[model samples]
Target: MTGKIRGISILALLSALAAPPALAQSAAPSTAQPAAPQAADASQLEEIIVTAQRRQQNLQDVPLAVSSLGASDLQDRQIRDTIDLIQHIPNLIGNNNVGLGSSNTYYIRGIGNTESIATQDVPVGTYVDDVYISRQNANNFGLFDVERIEVLRGPQGTLFGRNTTGGAINVIMKKPSATAGGYLEAGAGRFGETDIRASMDAPLSDKVLTKVSMYRNRSDGYVRQVNTGDKLNGSDNYGVRGAVRLLPTDRVTIDLAGDYVDENEANLINRVDPATGDRIATIGITQGALAKYFTGTKANNEVGNSTKSWSLSSNAAWELDDLTLNSITGYRQTTQRYFIDSNPAAPNPIATGVSPILNYSLHQQWSQEFKANGQALDNRLNYTVGFYYLHENNWTDLGTGVGTASGFTVSGDRTIKNTLDSYAHYAQGDYK
Candidate 1:
């Protein structure tokens, strides 16, 4: 595999480790039981705010359909990644094809792209901290210190720049708080699983604050490999994030954050089928005895995978008497690699041997956005306008090895390149 393809494949594998469960703080009430009539006051109601249109507004007041999941809600559901979050969001579905590594496809409102090619962009747009993610392979970035996740349904052609035909997901990470505090959590579960997470926030100075966070997860495989007596479908991952906040003045603020993640694991499992509807007690065949029937001498194939990634982002805001200016910038790079059996001995070809496919891919992306919003016509109406830019590059390598009884092998290589750029201005108004 080429260097670029190898890099992307590694990134894909690493992303799986970062997948954090979706936690929504507002999905349920603080108390387990219903409250008394007298307690049902305005103060008792849960308030949900969203920025689907690049401006903060009450979620109920927005015309578009959207689902807002808060920290508490996410925690309650035990959600730890986009795949799990999709289950809670109506009209959305996602699934990972086993043995395909992290190549997952998402469908929104019954529309989505299933092809796993690096050159093809997802019909839906995914954003973290208001920064657009151009490549679908990068969607596995874990959720850490995330304050909220907004899944906007329907086409968002006006505000979001590209690939918004289906919808958009907005991941808002927690900002550095002025308060000094931290939290650590660890958990162990069935299947030789363990997880560790740590986070801390401290005031660097009177006007500056810093935050750091990290997590690690590991699990034993659930599937057993008969050939090597090894288990398949296990994973390990680690990642860190750092942030610095600058409050130069009361009306102006700047925040800079960066994160990195690494992961390695054996992914996917395959088995031989006797073809007959009824089960059979091990087809009577020996390794060397079946060598002639097998075009490839290889008896069994395995799936191995790995990935790594790094990202940087900045969110700055300046406030004036009647207007606020906001700018967001972000950059990310990732790599992924994996091996799978292209052809398995099944009902059609029981005597034929298995052929393994080796594939690798890489991806790098950068994006920037600027927006200005203010009240107009004596505060009776609010307005917003913005500009956006994004760039992405990727590479991939795919080849298959056919093992013959004679121990013969052959392989080939394929390459791909892609680029996208866009600019737009938008304006919105609301009457209160």
Candidate 2:
């Protein structure tokens, strides 16, 4: 059993090092075994491995511009979510667009998707364990128990297909291992923040291994309501993940994993007037008399969000003499319900029978991919060929109507529903 708490702040750091060359020494020619090399120090850079080409390879040999962060590197940098990567990744800009509690808008090289509609396509694609994430609002995953994150720049259309016009962000999770070990971590910071994280790995049999992890966090809002003293823009969330690995034979391996996330957090809009650099009032509230403009509000504070998401995936691989066969299958679903203050400069929602703007969305997607990687021509040529299929269903509703103390009695609503199916066949080969 696992438990979680949500909403905390994170900080990060980056460092660089320069190493001087070692002096050469003259030695007499001898047929004796060479002396063992000295132990490497901090100046020696560690070798980095990546799967940017759908196959594990040295980072320096991928023949593409890619950045990677390992688990230890992420912990050292205090990276908590996708948004935190902006500071560390080059030519990247990311943020949570107003109103969505757990969604992300990302731009790479001046290309991105701002609209959350179902028909729109994200120029930058996001993936986990080779499974494609089809929605923008569904890609802002909280980082925990991550093995590594790889950011590939420039167009990757030939391999990644559509939505790769900008680039791709691939997140790899830590898998179940034969070792039985785990860890627990707790932390606290300003704004009444607290967090707890725990994980455990257990082996069920000689060939079966399982791992589970959970996290919870909570924090007070950065913005406050002057009259009610209520916090806005705070977080309350928890999540859990489980993975199982099976090795039925020496040449075959299978992995199955699942995860779920829940968030109940406050959302507030804080806009500034660029001309005067003062906070703008909403719903006929005074211009600046209630409280300081920076972090104070006087509007009705009945806005918040509820989000839930879950996913399941399976991966299998079979090794052959000169080739490898792989299959990846995944399914995901998300539901988000949120409301926002719509009355700009009218009789406050309290006086008028006006309701807040209500927004809701439900999304589902699944994908299947089968591929083979092999070398030919005396091991001088390497190739990958694959077939892919994707299915998606999405629903969205936006409405406004009469307001009540408990909730809005929506009288008007606009609903949209869409379904899509896609298929592709691709092949790539490299010769030396």
Candidate 3:
């Protein structure tokens, strides 16, 4: 089936090239007028272009409720991931689970998923370079080298497929340019903090252009694990992206890109006294038992977790007479593992010789998408239509074991496997 689709895609490319020159000449007018030529107030209403309906259109011309954030806004506001951007964008909020890296939930307009299970569904969809990212663990993939981010409000059922009841976030990364240039940024703040980002783009030849970007971030925890007298919460994150643009001729362009990310850290901690619902005392708990037997300590309980993710994408475009054709294909994979301590007690009250409660979990997922879109009828009737498929597998194990106290052993496990395949076709027109 995959081979057949590839062959069909190739045939479509050839047919587009064979289209009549008259059509090409007609479509050429749109590109002739660059966006910069017509501008309103440069600061208030910047000329924003978006692929909301799969074609670049003026932001104001689109009826959908949408907000766009350029690179400058992201950096200025310290927006790092979907979680950090939620408060900045109107009507968006996200919460990180206590000990589960796979269960980060996002709420848009008060609609979202609260469950942390890997098999659970989400109302808001997240996409990077036109590829859908279904898992929350992949959400921390870093936002360096991004060109712009578009948040489309309201249900995008007609175009974005299932699980978009609330809205969708589209993250567009900078494409490799024919010119050679790049930037490097480094910053430091409180709590043993450090951030490094770099990107470079150069032309390999007349037909090929390449771009590479990398980022690294590390910080010392603000909270201390009283049990072990060690830093309880902090993070180490790094990723790399590489893309190649192949433009054999003026009418055809192909872009291929791939990225990988790794994130590690000591999980979060929460301290509570069941009797008083207040802070508990940590006097005798040792470091070895805290690291081996307990998932998380009182200081940063459930907040410490780690994730690793990677993805690849390809975009091919062909310009014909009255219409332009585009094919976007992408795949992503992610793995997340973390542990949390649900309960902490003094004198090991819960158990005779064991710690309180320990919880551990792991999640893995893979997703893919293929879409084709363009405009029609003298560019007045713009449209986007495509088919999407996804398959995900999840494994979760929760366990509580013996601590220095006594008689504390409990465990549970759950596994889920899901596959979704869908096909959709949509068309929208503009009078002006």
Candidate 4:
């Protein structure tokens, strides 16, 4: 939704306070699918805009099970990330892989991926700015600068993809406005916690507009190491997003956006001995390394995890009277690395030390989509047609020290890579 800045747009301002993504306001051209209301008595309640079918319609009018949370709703609830909303949404579970930062497993309606391996697939699909995130390692991030979130339960294999067999998490980012205005905010809390968020929207000439948003958060953590006094389960992360929109003609609109995020946190430990409620002291793990891995309440290992990622996207639309043509292009890259404290309490051990075991996962993807939508039969018939293509490359590297309980040590390494391409052409129509 864009145009005349008559009075004040409260939704825009409130959304700026939270700084959402620059998701386009219009829907992609796709077949008409039945809408199902995830909420009861939706028609009697507030009218929510829905796009589960790749067409804009009211929540109550759609024939699919869907739920939505607007930007203001998320901000009022102080929902900063996916983990915060998981508990509130029914049947939606986003596990952080027992304290690993880069591992996020989302279970919607109890049908998500069970394996933590990077080469596997996720039943529930997640999208940001209409671009499929595909992998969970990059799915868990601060939901700052968002417009709204739509949760569709059940198989969404029609318009989305096979990965959406369980459901889809649709995220729309706030688009840049022709109006020139912005927002800033800061806060502090317990455990040395602090939050800083800001966003700015500006118009360059009559046809070009741009917006930039960023946020930073940190915490001292509640748990600590018994031996080294190091804080566990703490976070230090920052992210930034920028976009430029150009109206080259009366019928054409173009948008280019880029985003980057860096996450560094002390992961929660994964394992603890049941007998003594203590970490298994390994013969190869040092006291300090062992302490760091199992320092906190949810102990697993000594070394935490770190991740860095970036993305670029372009969306263009052309209106041809009653018919509209839309195109989307996207590219993304992400990397995650984590380590664990090896136990030294083996039956036979001469050297007691902590083994540094680490794994690095990387993902790169590019996608293109073209769509056409129009109406016929005295405006009673609505239809959509689209073509989609995606190319993805993923790899993993595992590095660890192989050792025996009898004081043995050897370095081990392994790497694997895979490439995949997908294509689809779809069309559907409905008569009112």
Candidate 5:
């Protein structure tokens, strides 16, 4: 064991590690204190807790630049999706392209993808709880039942790994609590939009608790199809999430979560902006067919999309005397298809064989993470060390058939598949 190149001993650096100046926090006790807790007053400012670094801390205490939206902020602002969030946050923008609603493009600090292609990975990293979502297309998520959303600006190589080169976002869902309570909600909006949501939390016993939440949203598409003269672009979506908490012991906690989203809507098409009353200019398309791009135009604008996604995750934490160990495992999959009429106009005898298509894609991802976080030297030092592994597989179907109004049919079809596997080990410490 001794026949090796002489190396510096890690022990020699012990004196170099300085501890930060902060009060050490004691782990949560098993039994509640006999004294009743004081109620917080709404009129007074409250403390905001965040897990941006894989550990809970006051938002103001974190060293990095961060922005956060809480559940109340989301509801009061009517932010149902990340797209909606773009309006409130600075230096953020959402792609104006017709998107199916699940994974839309977003720009943070001018870093993001302009195209909606599922294969491209955007620079902004997104995480659900502690699980990292690698691909940009998978970052678009519904904002229902979310506890908080934290946007961390700048590179995060230590905790989040490569995908956070631009930045990172963490979406935290409300987990099951040791309580028996529930609520129901419903709302209506313009454009035939209606939403219904319900959630219930109950205790299975003293050691186990569970919670389930679901919502259904429906709205009329604003555009009109040429063939059926039916409403074209609109909203139709629904999603549900469920969670369970196992507290077998005071020091050990386990959380299991599963959720699914189904989105069905017409493919995004060129249309006149309602507010501006201006017809959208077509690119690479003839001027004569420009009128067909209007939302209510009679050209056969037959297009639609069906997007489905689901995810499962487990988080286990063991609280020790001065530290916490966490294990997070996750699996996610998505399937989406975009259907469009190659010829939205009347089929001409000359171009009878042409067909138009956007793209169909399938993706699956799985990851595992282990983290150790805690205080050292009587709360003077804060540190986090973790390992992460991620694997992804994606498949896409491409259709090619270019025909003028003369009716050109598709001449070729192609398929592509990609697989990726990567892992990382990282550690960081803050000593005051």
Candidate 6:
């Protein structure tokens, strides 16, 4: 739903947090089938492989209720980011309610986290290339050169461990291709929106392969400021990823990958009356105070959200006679800064009332996991066991200023820090 204010489209009046792109061979503008390999029989269905149980198996063979989107599925459906999965995955919901450009709040079966604080944990765990992402901030990443996306629809504590009480989401990136091939894509949308995406795959040798992918997008704000003729509720963000796959031998494989993302977005806008908590009038002489404030002119100090993050990971596997041994190690860091102009509608800048809120966060974490999977009893029994370790530290800084008729006050800035160290051994087995 949308409206217009003085010939300007009110694309987004609720908050500057406006939310929710395109393609390649799997993402071309054609109505082609998904990337899953089809069975030789014409009447047979395509075989969809999944790692929901920490092992590759036919999607239907897995007992859990799973939703899988292959590369072609994502491209055909235009599922450009993490948030877009909600539309296609049943009983799933996501949004950028955290107010950060690259942040997200996801709910699966009505269980999830809404706060962006560093101390709290998200019930719904998120993973990329088998590495866990502990923080929700900057988790809303742009999807490029993806292999598949899997959403597990129930408690996954057995295999995923803590924070999986709700469920889990897995993003499997496209590994370096054996053959040399890639694609480039560009797109445009309303409100001066534009984006570019590209990926390239190169094989250095018979045993070495490498690939890189990147994307960037920008759009004008939908909510227009009549005074300055500038729009609010806009975003500018970009990300890049590089991967290398080493096939030391037929029975051993190794993968090394790293990625970085940056985001800058407009600040949140007040669209409702603070006193009565009613919708502010955006039209005519009866315009509410907040609406009038939006139209009125003032000093332009566009204090918004700026976030930057990066990570590196390595994964290796060894295939034995009857068992598969795997190890994964990862390290990640993030920094975010944002501010809220509490109130500029006050009659007096220093006395009548105004409060400004500012926040800063710095976080980093590292984790390692070793696991083994195998089957016995004439292939009727399947099992997996793993040991995991993790360490993380976070720092948060907060500041605020208040104004009143009597006097003005500025609160001293404060910082909060938290650190965590965890270790556990888990095992799961299934028998027919």
Best by lDDT: 6
157-252 in candidate 4: lDDT tens per residue? 767877898899998888899999989989999889999989999899779999999999988765544334456567888999999999999999
Return the top candidate by TM-score. Answer: 2
Candidate 6 per-residue lDDT over residues 1-432, each given as its tens digit: 234463354445432344212223444467765568755888877899999999999998999989999999999999987988888999888877445557788889999888777889998889998889998877888899999999998899888879888899999999999999999999999888998999999999989999999999988766543233445567788999999999999999999999998877744543554565533212111112222222111112244567889999999999997799999999999988765455635433323444654567889999999999999899888999999998999987765556432444666456779999989899999999
lDDT per residue (tens digit) for residues 1-432 in model 3: 999999999999988887877587666756465545455566786678997876788999888889999899898998875567777889888766544433457778888886555567788888888777776655645789999999888898777767789998889999999899999999998788899999999899989999999999888765554445456556788899999999999999999999988877533444554565643333233323444433433212243566777788888888776556667777766665555454444444233333333333344434444454555566666556555556555554444444443323434323444554445555555544
What is the TM-score of each predicted model, taking all chains together? 0.78, 0.80, 0.76, 0.77, 0.78, 0.79
Q: Show where candidate 5 strays beyond 4 Å.
A: 1-45, 96-98, 116-118, 273-302, 340-357, 400-406, 409-412
Q: How do the residues 1-432 of candidate 2 rate in per-residue lDDT, one tens digit apiece? A: 122222111111111112122212324456877879878797966889998888878897889999999999899999887778888999988776455667777888888887666779888889998999888765666788899999998888777878888899999999987989999999999888888888899989979999999989888766543334456667888899999999999999999999998976644454454565633323222222211211212222235666788999999999998899999999999887665555544333334433355567889999999989999999999899899999999997765555444343545567779999999998988999
Q: Write the per-residue lDDT of candidate 1 for residues 1-432, one digit (tens) a residue.
A: 699999999999877756543233435456666645664567665779988888888888789989999878887887666667778999888775334444456788887887566677787788888888776554655566778899888988777755888888888878888999999988998779898888999988879999998888888766554434455566777789999999999999999999988866544535443453322211122234322332332322224566677899998999999999999999988876665545544333224444555556678888888899899788998888888777777776655555533453655444556665656667677787
Could you tell me the lDDT of residue 236 within candidate 2? 87
Please report how far candidate 6 places residue 2 from its true position, in Å: 35
lDDT of 5 by residue, 1-432 (tens): 343323344444543453222212224354655757768887976789998777898987889888889999999998887768778877766753344545666667777765555566767777898887765544566677889999888887778888676677789999887888988889998779998888899889978999999989889866654324456557688899999999999999999999998877644444564566633211122222422322222122225666788999999999999899999999999877654444433233122322445556788899999999989987889999988899999887755455544443445556778898988999988887
Clashes of 4: 37
Q: Which stretches of candidate 4 lie over 4 Å from their true place?
A: 1-44, 270-302, 341-357, 399-413
The per-model lDDT (C-alpha) reads 0.70, 0.76, 0.68, 0.74, 0.72, 0.78
Task: Compare candidates 1 and 3 on TM-score and give the better one.
Answer: 1
Which candidate model has the greater TM-score, 2 or 4? 2
Clashes of each: 41, 7, 21, 37, 16, 0
Model 5: lDDT to the true structure = 0.72
